[model samples]
Target: MSKKILISVVGPTAIGKTKLAIELANHFNAEIISADSRQFFKEMQIGTAAPNSQELASAPHHFIHHKSIHENYSVGDFEKEAIALLSHLFAKNDYVVMVGGSGLYSDVITKGLDKFPNVSPDIRKNLNEILKKEGIGPLQRQLKVLDEKSSNSIDLANPHRLIRALEVSIGSGKPYSSFLNKDKEKRPFKTITIGLQADRSIIYDRINKRVEIMIDKGMVEEAKKLYPHRILNALQTVGYKELFRYLDGEWDLEFAISEIKKNTRRFAKRQLTWYRKNQDIIWFDFNMSKADVFQKIDKEIITVQNE
Candidate 1:
């Protein structure tokens, strides 16, 4: 084997990405590295939709359930760890597959993470605290002043991203864009991106139904256990964040359920927006038959091997 191929399967939530990725991994005789930010934590299985053991048993996987919810993990950390894992896996197997909806995490591996100067922990903590107390509006203001270009392009509703941009701005006294737009670093492998796409209505319906299934699978109780840590950045996810409102008495049960569906649909939109920017992707519609998708993927792998 040439050891130069890494196939990435990416798409919006509940678009059957997991099932497809596993099939590709099997077809290529490779393992999987997850790019999901939430699924990194061990205690977050139900809410994060982390793969069950049976699914994992179908293929050797990495970076799933690898950390505690209490531990802090960043895109930089993911880049370092995932790359190391890839290097090790590629040493044994010629190719590997990475799959998830987290665009930043995938970018960290493919486009290369930008290097930034260190900032004191105090600045990050204080910015996070103020963000919690004041909501997204305050951080939005700071990020606009600090990096208007990137700020305008990002999801304004995501306070964690907004505040992180602010922290980088204040800490380095430079626009976050300065660091973000740095040149991409080279990697050894040839990347073959396979994007899963579907009709807008179908994707939205899947997202809504997936949220309901998550709740029925004990996501509410899981959120309750992590409510004390809701202020943590990792807990800023869609499903758990909405349920936290119910736990805090801000919304009735039915209202919270509705919010989860609405917010998840919004998340799927954001995900599509994010992935659309990557033109390197070879998109396959979600309606394709499983065997057909795998055949396409396997042919791509063999094509890559020939190169």
Candidate 2:
């Protein structure tokens, strides 16, 4: 039998990846698996730019709002579940489309996660204490010194990610990034990555506009609903975090909105940094017509399957 194909739609946030994935899925009669970490939570639909009702109806989708914010979900858990879902999907369709801006989550499907040495629980406890007392600055600086690559690519604003990287680097006496992609498990399906990108200025402009749209669509209200649960890892993302600060009275709404746009731009840049290293993604300008992208993807699918 011919190898099945997994077509990944990846790029920075607000870049039309979901639209493209739906079109691809429709054309191929395939299903979509969302690798976006934020979209997993049911409460974060507006903030995460999750597919709307029409989009969900256009394609069969998995892993979108399938978990609650209160659940303790990890990348390892996602890997197990997604791999099993792929097995079921491949048995029915020749192509399966996975779409998301969360590069780490996407990588777990394409390249299996690397295992790191266990660190003492006290290390995490100390890091949490530092975060609570001094804020995320000290931990960020520590990761910057210990694993510069991870510091550059991962979400620096997330205290959980910072602590995880720092603990691994501190305990193993090796840069946390050094352990990544070291044991990529083979998958039965052939994988093809499609990246949508544009100039930095254009990307930033899109992010700004999207943030404004989200605010108009009641993202502030959504954030308010989730604010009581701000400590949840799911709420630590860009849009809600900024709104949480606004709700905290630390900054005015205007300033909070601006920070949301600014932080989202930074997140997009970090996403590009992570994906550029893969070298497998076939990139297209975000403005390219869907027809042209579909033509190119068809060629790539044929080429990948023949390899």
Candidate 3:
């Protein structure tokens, strides 16, 4: 049997993953599957930086703006849907490119998800109560003590993720991290991971510039349209949350924009930390030319095929 390759393009936000993925997909004659959680929402175009018309035209992309903000979408859901799509795509082509900065979503498509014992719904309910009453800090601190690795990798600001982790820890009497990298379901195809990276200073600058561009691209107006749906999990992201604060009179526009830039930089740092844990990734500088990147990916694919 022939082997299909899923070429995953992963990196921090604003690190040019989209550009690189398009080039790779076009060169390899493959379609692109997006694993970016924020980019999945149809209402979060500007803020999430969903591909522009031109970029989308460059190559066929899937899973972008495929869900509504009001819908309940989870990593598990993405995994199943993406795998289904890949099955169809792989039947027609041996190579498919997956791109996104979302580590867990990407892992579901590439490394497979970890299994966990069932936790009572009451546990999740109680955790939500705690989050509502006390905010995310207590849950974060608790997770840090119980599962430091999860705390490091998770988006601490996300109430849904924090509550899920806490419920598992409380119900199973074991840290969440203990459940990871175990019982990973094997996939039929092989994955070749390519990661983009840069110095901290360069990454931070790129994030800042991207935030400015988002704001200029009417991020505030976009957030306003979704402000009524602010309580949705999709709106809990960095750019929208900051602008929602501005709408709430918590901060002025300038201050809110600054907060967005700061939080985005922090998010990018966490993304880098997550990707660094995977030793299989072949890293490339963010500024590497497209031709050079294609050369590297070509070499990596050849190595995988020969093995």
Candidate 4:
């Protein structure tokens, strides 16, 4: 029996990962499993840069818009469901492609989820109270003090992520980052990770353009509809959060759009910071031609298969 391969296309947001993944899936005669946590929610289509109808029809895709914003979906849940789906996929195809910008979720599939000490519910309760009384600012400052590394890498804008890190840091009497990348679960398939990257200026420019396209595609209207559910964890995203502020009358639409661009740039930087730590990823310029990229990935696949 031959071993299966999981080719992961990963990089910063708006870096053409979805296009590359579709092409690879078609070349390899495989299906795609989305590791982008934000894309899993059905309500966040326009803002999350989810594959459109044409793109979804281009290849067999899994895990995109499979959950609702109202549902509680964790990385652990994703790991279980994705692995099961992979087993079913591998039975029919020798290769499968996984793509996303969510580093933590992707890591769960490739390198097992990290184990953390049990945190007391009271600690999270206290943190939520603080967030309610003040805002995410104080909690952000506290995490910066407790786990500066995590502060730089994780999405600092997400309150659920912030609270999770704080509770673990406080409960375990150690930095939250101290618990990461400590566990490895051997998988049944060989893995190849391809990363797309570009100059910081180019990446930021792409993000700015993407945000504009989203706004033009009625992201504000989508946010307005979901604004009533603003407190949901799924709603705690870059694009929607900014528009939520606009809807709250805290900022005008222009200012909100600018903040969305600025925050998205920061999110892209953090994503690169996270993926850079993984030495196994093969990096490529985002503008590389499809044929050239395909050649390099094919060579890698052959090398891994022979090993």
Stretches > 4 Å off in candidate 2: none
Per-residue accuracy of model 4 over 1-307 as CA lDDT, tens digit each: 6679999999999999999999999999899999999999998999999999999999999999999999999998999999999999999999999999999889899888888889889999999999989999999999999999889777777899999999999999999999987857899998999999999999999999999999999999999999999988898889998899999999999999999999999889889988988999999999888899889888887898788
> Which candidate comes out best when scored by lDDT?
4
Q: What is the TM-score of each candidate against the true structure?
A: 0.94, 0.95, 0.96, 0.95
lDDT of 2 by residue, 1-307 (tens): 5779999999999999999999999999999999999999998999998999999999999999999999989999999999999999998988999999998899999888788898899998898899889999989988988889999778888887888899999989999999976867888888889999999999998999999998999999999999999987788889998899999999999999999999999899889888989888899999889899889888987787678
lDDT of 1 by residue, 59-152 (tens): 9988998998788788888998888888988898788999999888887898899888788889878977887688778778777777898787
The TM-score measured for candidate 4 stands at 0.95
List the candidate numbers ranked by lDDT, top first: 4, 2, 3, 1
Better of 3 and 4 by TM-score: 3
Query: lDDT of candidate 4 vs native?
Result: 0.93
Which scores higher on lDDT, 1 or 3?
3
**Could you tell me how far off, in angstroms, the CA of residue 122 lies in candidate 2 after the best superposition?**
3.2
User: What 10-residue stretch in candidate 3 is worst by lDDT?
Assistant: 293-302
Compared with the true structure, what per-residue lDDT tens digits does model 3 show for residues 1-307?
Answer: 5679999999999999999999999888999999999999998999998899999999999999999999999898998999999999999999999999989899888888888899899998887788779878889999999899888878888888888888899899999988988777789899999899999999999999999998899999999999999978788889999999999999999999999999999898889888888999999898888888778777877887888
Reference-based lDDT, each prediction: 0.85, 0.91, 0.90, 0.93
**Clashing residue pair totals per candidate (backbone < 3 A):** 0, 0, 0, 0
